[model samples]
Target: MATDGPNLASTYEYVIVGGGIGGITLAARLHARLPEASILVLEAGSDPSTHELATSASTVSAVRSNADLTWQLPIEPCKGLGNRSSIAQVGKGLSGSGAVNSAAWTRGPACDYDLWAHSVGDQGWSYESLLPYFKATECVRGMKINEDHHGYEGLIHVVPVKANWAKRTYPLRKAVQEAWAQSGVDYIEDGNAGDPLGLTELVEAWDEGKRQLPSKSFDLEGVDIVTDTLVHRVTFTQDQGHEPRAKGVELISGQHINATKEVIVSAGVYHTPKILILSGIGDPQTLVAHSIPLVHGNPEVGNNLRDHLSVALTWKLKHPEIGLALGSPLLTDPSYANGAPLDFIQFGRVPTNLHTEMLLTSKEDKALVLRPKACHTESILLYTYMGPHMSGVNVPMDGTYITTVTANLAPTSRGHVSIHSKDPQQPPKIDVNANDTEVDRHILREGLRNISKVLHETPSGQSFIDSQVPPEGYPVLLPDSKDEAYDVRIRDFGFTLDHPMGTAAMGKVVDASCRVIGVNGLRVVDASVFPVPIAAHIQVAVYALAARAADLIAKEQ
Candidate 1:
């Protein structure tokens, strides 16, 4: 709300910090089930309604961006990134990263979630068990998904590109399909059903031409929403020699809001653990260092941070005047500006021989064993020029560029997000540890090569493409380029995919029901609770997770 308002309750049954998707889902579900239960969501950022671009999909930058809308977190120098640090765009508004992320609704493979159930020892967390929750979140009408795998009357609107649909027939769609087919990557009709191991039509979280904001997508009536408010720490009502029970939260301004029953932390990956640490729920040594008396110590609170790091490799189209790309006269139909400019998304793996050659940890081995054929590389196609991805690569803005943004989906690299101070306002230190292992570097390099193979070696690609647009000092890296050249491009220009997770990991920090270990009446209900990295856009899985988390909360009561 514009202000906390005079009618705010002195105490609520539930006080949730961070009104992101998780907060929204949990509040909406709980309130709907128990209409009289008092619920309050404290959000540090303002209402997304004030930001027009938060819901606009007219440009390639549809990954919602309004500088004032995010927590501009900084990363430390990484040995893998050639000591170059990049800024992490973390969403701070009510919808969280869903407000600032590339809105592709890719749900990843079933193995990604099935493995979670195996690792966490919770059969209920398996893909089959969680299918209903997944179906409950998205309204998949007109899209041909696998049998019994989706819902029709869900909240989030989803639509896939069809050849006959208006403005849906994008140029290069045929070329991309034929190119991948020629490259041995056949097409898959449904990427969200169980697996997405091949070329699939790009499905997004947009309806026709507009993307719906989280508040519009979910039912959150009669719930109190306090915006532009910061949470200082979770307060506990304790008796000595026993675990503390969460009473409520204290705001950054020293104002106290009480939760009679429970307090939930739905802050994003980076900030959730920071809040926990500030609340005396982290490692005792660290809490002592910060001069904060400890209530409970959980060393794993801010560890095991995992994320996807990607890089853009551009290719200049052989023909620009033909008007296939954005900004071209022939494409000025306005309808073409509807969703993301990309036509298709391909998920595959690097050469298996390369993966087997590297020394892997026990965790990586077991994860691979469960996800035997999990996607390791994901490539996104952009119809317009993305030349600014690299310096010295001078290309005109005449719409001659077609880019392939590739990411390492199954990265073995593990990072961390930790608090350096006791202050809640200070953002956590995020070390994504991009390309930390040789395996990750090669996965990224080969991912780029896989995209390049469609162009450099395929007949369909040669029909429309000309040459690679490499940085000024380097030669164009081909599909069979040496490991050294691929390494150079990756180390110099790799960027975070902005999909971070694993901080307050499930098995380590929270129990199967998302309850914080060693504490009472407190839970973590966001990506931070994910035990491992999900190999897709993540927002879909997060929504599914929220649905299940809400159910779990209801059952416990």
Candidate 2:
């Protein structure tokens, strides 16, 4: 299945940059809507041959495997994280991050979409307008016959947990539900059904125990896909010095692929803004400093960078089964257990009553929720995901740690993404400035405290936990609490969710229609255009946005 050459070397009606969820979803939608139009996707990295790179926790692990799917570019050092420069993770192959993400596809509360639409002044962007497209991307498999929020037929597969698995995670969840009820927050059957409150089982993207890819499901035969191609810059033609009309895209290899009607930038938050700045459509001051000629003076291009900061809290469990290792040879061995882990479970919650949830847990559970800030800030929990197995931690030879991680899904602090140089090959400067906001820091602290409470509530609780973080009870932030020092202790250990968004904000840099303000034949359809980070995981929202963009682009064409 080696691709002989660029799928469509020199000509295409549409050229999409970045083949991740955003790009692939649009590619599929375009083929379904416009069968005759030729589409080309340019990815900078190589195709990942194995799912390991796609599923690994470390960003570098994803890029290491596929030479054709990942190309390491030198990023100018970031100022937020002590002036140390690091490489940013971007997809270079067909499935993009869809191949590597944790695969939790949760649609954030509908309120987020409504707010986004209002901010952008687009009537077509409300939750109602976007729901159909959400349905279009999902194929909910094996659900209750009467499940209304689930989809019947769609390209991507949605797999819920099996009966036994759901039962196992139920106790932990039930404890939390009981706690939330005491706090006066009612539970809902489905989080995606308009209101997201209380405990809910997350919907994952999987088919027969493997990750789902949009290319296979979305494109039965119509779309032309290209991997190993990087879009260096967007080519444009100006008319009367008004809005610039998109012509095509220039590849990293210097090949120019034409976009007959329009070129949509579906790269995710990091690369979308990078591409914009490289194309000369960003903050003129930053662009000028990088020595790049300004194409459009949109100062908001890379500002308002926001992401959910995540930290892992771990504990040693009483039962070894609770911390069974999926990657262990006994479980993952081809001949043993059919390559299934002894125990792998996930339970989700939409924090409606944050205060009471924190108060219910023991001090040890609080540590699991939010690690003492003075301890490892990079991770928040001390998880006993696996222990004392024949294989140590079941980790690969690489530097990846096979432990559980939890991120504060909503962060109040905002950051920025700016261009370091005019060169597309050069990575953009990413300044998350994480935890700078006291509100975000306090929220994370509260969230950790709540999770810790859940850990100590039942047999499902501390039984599987190996150790408690902070070696002390949960950190307290209340005004009357005598432990004022705990507040300072919690702030020191905050981490980044690695989920950045809001650059090239919807109403500010781009209109509600996703069209770049003051520019024509150009639009940003990636996560960058999200005015604010949605309350749930970002992957689903990115796909939904791409689907919506395809509709807008097709109508105009």
Candidate 3:
């Protein structure tokens, strides 16, 4: 099940593992830096999808489940969450998750990059230093001065939505502005130039009228983008004194890849640390428990996992007229198609070092505040072509399957990733530990109340009239008043699974350079390396992190 890779076994200078955005982007940079260096990228996914219809959806349906891109499922059950672990939905294809993710090209405040550098103690990783790279990869559309915040000419194409769906979704931006006005925050038209305090329409990665694929955006020639090849282990050779030096990796089918210069690990957060531990480079206790020998005793390898926990506050729309239903009759008309329905009311802020926000606060108010801040708070975003016209009034069990979801960025609770087995096929134990930190819970509690306050405003009535499901009927954690109990009930069941970050965190286990501590020739360049989750959607930041890492790797060479 392996594809032929470029002939780099003879004179290859670098052999990168994983061909996601990070690997491909780094290959481009590496090609520019050491043009003469032969680079081979080993991807465990398919080449790329060319189906235009597959790229138009908002959820996982946008992805084509080809054998080359989908990897083996998790081996067995995990210890956490009552041992009911699910299969991780990450992309294994050439472009990786970027190929199937909702194409929202959001860049949080510049402070996010600065925070990353400061946390890892990496010199020159501040926003000022990395701004050029962020701007270098972006191609802004729709707004003037996009060049000021985005790159006018870049390999990846960035386009704006001009359909009716976008227009209907645009009003949510105004609603959030009016909501946040009560809290005394200023608005910024562009969130990428730093200072993401207010509401703005997000920019997404798309072509002139469609989404862009990594296959088309990257330089695929010469660079061997091998798909459907699963790397089981990083083969290491002991040095003169028996120290482990990562030489290369071995595929599942028994093909050995030898690295001439270096074997860069960009297998993302979940697998990166798992690979290190299997290679004997994690906590001594964890290694011993899993019956694996220890290489370096870094207790922090799987610690410090942070994610932006989201809680949603959904309501049935009073009239189909408030959103996208008004334009339903014109779907067949070419001049009026491709429009977005629901509006977004997202928010974010620094985490408080408390135990939990939802636990300490009243329920009803929690639901209200979450409507504007905690869950889906995007400064810049995209309007999907999908419409949310429900055929009936049945409430969905899936918290956000068809409703508005608000999010809380910066959580105080810390989760962890641990290997259940030493086998490469086994999935790591990923317990989100959501709502464990009082500080994080409090933020959600407060955020919910704020949003509830805004929904009571004049313009908001058009959307919420006869649409809300009251919290008064909730079984437990009931509040005395309508507002008090609203947020609490929402907190109890309004959980979100988006924005998982930190597993193999930077600084503690991996150094400021994203290199795993005490390990040679190994590095992480994904969401796992984030010391903490940034203030916006992590997808763009992950790309930026890869960009910074690529430059660092080049400089080291």
Q: Taking the tens digit of each residue's C-alpha lDDT, what string does model 2 give over 2-49?
A: 252565657778877877778878877877788888876666655564
Alpha-carbon lDDT, every model = 0.81, 0.59, 0.58
lDDT of 1: 0.81
Error of 3 at 194 (Å): 0.7
lDDT of 3 by residue, 1-557 (tens): 12555333533567777877777777777777777777777876666565454355432443534434444334223222223333445666767777766566666666656666766677466777777777777766555554556777666655444323443334344554555565454555565566656644445565533556665676656665666666777766766775577777777777788776677777766667777777788889888998887667888877766655554444544443333332344233432232233333244543333343445364322332232232324322112222222111244333221243455675656666778787777666666566564555556665555554445444643443344444345532211235346445434444433456777777777788777677677777777777756666666776667777777878988
| Pairs with steric clashes in candidate 1 | none
Q: Give the 10-residue window scoring lowest on summed lDDT in candidate 2.
A: 371-380
Winner by lDDT: 1
| Candidate 1 ranges beyond 4 A from true positions | 1-7, 59-65, 322-326, 354-358, 390-392
Q: What TM-score number comes out for model 2?
A: 0.78
Query: Comparing candidate 1 with candidate 3, which one achieves the higher TM-score?
Result: 1
Candidate 1 lDDT tens digits, 400-478: 8777789988887888888868877787878888888877887888888888888889999998788888887887889
- The count of backbone overlaps in candidate 3 is 56
Best by TM-score: 1
In the order shown, the candidates' Cα RMSDs to the true structure are: 2.0, 7.6, 6.0
Per-candidate TM-scores read 0.95, 0.78, 0.81
Model 3, runs deviating above 4 Å: 1-11, 51-54, 58-88, 160-186, 240-243, 325-327, 330-345, 348-402, 458-464, 470-492
